[model samples]
Target chain A: MINSEHTAIMLIAVPLLGAFTTAVFGRVSSSLRNIWVLAILASTELLAVLLGVNVLEKGINVYALGASFPTLTSPEGFPVRIILEVDAMNALISLIACTITLIVVVYCLGFMRESRVLDKAYTLILLLLTGMLGLTLTGDLFNLFVFFEVVSISSAALIAFYVHRGQSLEAAFKYMVISATGALILLFAVAIIYSQYNLLSMAALAASIKYTFLDEVALVLLISAFLLKAGSVPAHMWKPDAYGEAPAPVAVMLLTSALVSLYVLFRITYTVFNPVTPTIGWTLALLGVLSIFLGVSMALIQTKLNRLIAYSAIAEIGFILLGVGSSLTQSPHTSKVGFNALSGGLFHILNDVLDLGLLFLAAGAIYYLTRENNMNRLGGLGKTHPVLGVFFLIGLLAVSGLPPFNGFASKLMIYESVYFFNPLFAIIGILGSILMAAVYVKAFYSVFLGVFPPQELGQIPKSMLAAMGVLALLILVIGLYPATVIKYLITPAADALINPGDYIGGVL
Target chain B: MALKWRYQRMLANIAYITVVVLIGLGLYAIVFKQNLIKIVMGVHIMGSGVNLFLISLGYREGGVAPIYTLAPKLEMVLPTPQALTLTSIVINLAVVALMLSFVMFIYCRYNSIDSQDRRLRG
Candidate 1:
């Protein structure tokens, strides 16, 4: 029997196995493929939850494949076997990833019966989930790059799902260009680090090259590569168009799963580049500030519901960057900033995943009734689709950081921390929140509170609604008792982040 | 030890400068080109130039070729940079292929790949 440590790796591998079997089953009946895929996700999530509980009971778990378990060196000297590591931070992230997979599966079950290539879509979805899980759990930097490419390819393919449309195709093209470029740059950075340090293990690299010129270049390059992946400021140009034109469920998935990259960005910044350069912190803060302003401004102009949601996500991401940035600063950085900021950011990460996921699903529901994403055409939906509208309202409230929602807790943590950094920056962040509130209010009024649109007086799939319900419940739960979450999960992650010694020590 | 080491450094410097100039010119073409195909070609040029520069980073004055002989005492070139350039070339090839496929898809869909034509016609 596999132990608790290996369970985390299996959670990721199971879905990749499912994706493979689903593709093979595509030769069989489509219903069989769908059923098996759903079964895989449901089982994976159940296993993940069980494993997470076990890990919480018995501290962080580590697994090494082949040669030996935990610190095995290959006889070949090449060290070819993949090593998978799971800490408390990874366990929580795994739960979140699997939960999102579960919700997305339920959502897709009834969401796309009419599409001809539903089997392919399901396979891609499973593969994407597997890639994300692998990313969050992988130990080595080279494997991280490989997992990154896998994620990118699947995401890009999903973006181009409806190839008949000009908008989707164009968006996919731009996404392809940007993502391919980002991957190459990431590969270059990885190669540079490997050549300079001669160690592929992230922990080893962290240990060796403690303070040197090569380390500086590698750290800057690593930060740049992650920032590109995270879609901060300059690299954020592709996000709006790609998310806007994607089919609604995929957009929901995008909003939810995309936080993985930011999580990775922070992980690398903290672990690999221990005591990150002050310049990098200030770069994030600067880009974050710019993104906050630009994203809100862009959101104000968008008439399309998906584009508005996409832009709002950009603004929220800026807040996360701010929190992460200010964490390392604050006049003699404390254990609190890393803990507080990442805890807030990580909590907000899940919040955005659920709240914004529900909101996008709500947008999808609206589009189902009327086959347009334009907000000008949608009105008085609450009267006709009360359940959907209410959930969306919950999402809007939660997403804009209002009271009694998950976003508020996370946002408050960051807001207080940033205030610690600079009271003026905190004020600016608050102003951004207020702008977001106004935007959502306008969104609510335009979509749900006005005279009924004849086009939207209809029904949507119950499956999608159920998915939104799951997300909405999560939003409320996380919001109400964030401290419990911090105690169990964020504290460990914060410890992991600041203490590079474990990672370095383990590798060398 | 006294064989004018300054001359080798001078050679390296010239090679580096020329590589940079080539890359810069290619980038300028990419940024300034009006035609989409030209821009694609420009990117290819820039990529190739960068790859060459990376390969040159591995070269040493009197190093033997990267082939292994049973005999010892032959200093080998830096294999890391060569490996890096090889990876870059492959990745660039993939990018170029995908980009061309996209251009074809666009042309098939809209009957033109030119941004100017599409915008003006629209």
Candidate 2:
């Protein structure tokens, strides 16, 4: 067995090396490539789970690169080397990323079986996984920026996988431009922080940050850049285009990528800049409100299936932001309401990934059958694929925060806690959930319920069904056992956010 | 002695101003340019501006290069920013190549590189 100290780095390196190895195998035989890819993903998933368990059990796990021992974070009380820190929050997000990537790869096995670029697609997917895992685990600011670029570049390449479609190319261009700009802005912020302190490790920076004018400038830049990358409204135009045009499994990965950006946003705000001013908190809260309103309103009007789902994904991001932002407003003060809001936000991230992943997979199944994206052109799919229709319904209910599903459990937390923050915010959130229900119901009706002339449709591969089933099942389990998940996973994650001392102490 | 300090400060201000101008021009190009190639150029310019700013942060007056082999009994500039700038430059190169390739595909399909082309819009 690999030593537990090495799991964090292995979670990143295995896939980075596996990506090219898979490519080489791809050149020999496709089946061999598939097997190799699966092995890599499974091992990486195992590593993530191991890391998560270790962190949960023993507190923050720090692995320093180039150190004589992996656990040596700071040599002689100075942290100069690149470090990988797995606190509860990082572990939670990494587990989510890994599990979702595994499911998507399974789905891709069936979804892309007939595509010519299957080999290249798998390579890019592995690379994308490496990037996501690295983004979540790194403890250094520069390392974070590097992984940020990695995620952006790989996902942008995957977004254009369907090169024959001009729109895919167009969407990829737009995504690349936005991501490159966001990343450069992030680099600028890192440079600003480095210039001030000459320290690159997040723990050291957080410990030493004086909140000067330059620090404030760096803070603003970091927030804006990440918010832009996270696809919040007013900076969300690239999302619909990219998600609507990319292959379905890739779209799910893209959503996770955006969620990682959201994770980083919270990490920087709460940890690096602890006790952030109320003004920053208000800025985040207001943006969250705007994203909720604008995202759903825009989603309601979208005619394309994936684009509509993409807009709703933006709204889901808003809910998480609202919870985190409201909690931030009460910084340096651990109130029950703020803690509950933060827990809700963290819990919502898991629910969002499962719920949105299910919805996108179902949409892909329909598109696979019908070769149509416009909802108007799709009908009677439910009659043909009843299981898929039920899965879609599960996704629809969950995404709209209907009861007996995971979305409701988390959204309720957001609503209840944020209501205490501001009643008006909760009111708007409730209204947005209502409108979201309407949007998805309309989508369900148009895509699955309506009658159309029967036509021959190919069967959705068992792998695809299995993937969707896994997500639906997870959603149900979480919905049924919300308290259990919150007790074990989310509360610690939220605690990690509020208390940066543990993170700093683990390193310094 | 006061004049020397003033001159050094002015030089620093001028360097910072150049960085700002480069970034501004890049943003303008990205936001305003119709041609996809020009927008990509804009991204490159913006990235260059950031890289320049990062490198400037490491500059030290009358300092030797930050190389272990080149022994000098003098101050060495901060090496981290230079390493970071190099990484940023490589990332920008990959991004530009990807963008330009996408532009090539867009042009091939649409016969135009205009980002405002209707088919590319929502």
- Highest-scoring model, lDDT: 2
Best by DockQ: 2
Candidate 1 CAPRI grade: acceptable
Residue by residue across A1-508, what tens digits does model 1's lDDT show? Answer: 4565568768888899998889788788887887898889987888777777776677556667664655666442445445666666677777888888788778877677678878778888888888888888888776777677677767777887887776676676667655655564565566567656656677766666565776677667667766666676877877888888888778766665567878778777877777776777767877777778888888888899988988888888888888777775532255665568756766677777787788888887887778878888878888888998889899999988998888898899988877766787778888888898889889989999898787525567788888889888888887788788778777777666666676556545
Model 2, A53-117: lDDT tens digits are: 99989999999887865345442344447888899999999999999999999999899999988
RMSD of 2: 1.8
Stretches > 4 Å off in candidate 2:
A69-79, B1-8
Q: What's chain A's TM-score in each predicted model?
A: 0.95, 0.98
Docking class of 2: medium
Q: How many pairs collide in each candidate, listed in order?
A: 0, 0
Tell me the spans in candidate 1 whose CA falls farther than 4 Å from its real position.
A74-81, A330-333, B1-7, B10-96, B116-122
Clashing pairs in 1: none
What is each candidate's DockQ, to 2 decimals? 0.24, 0.80
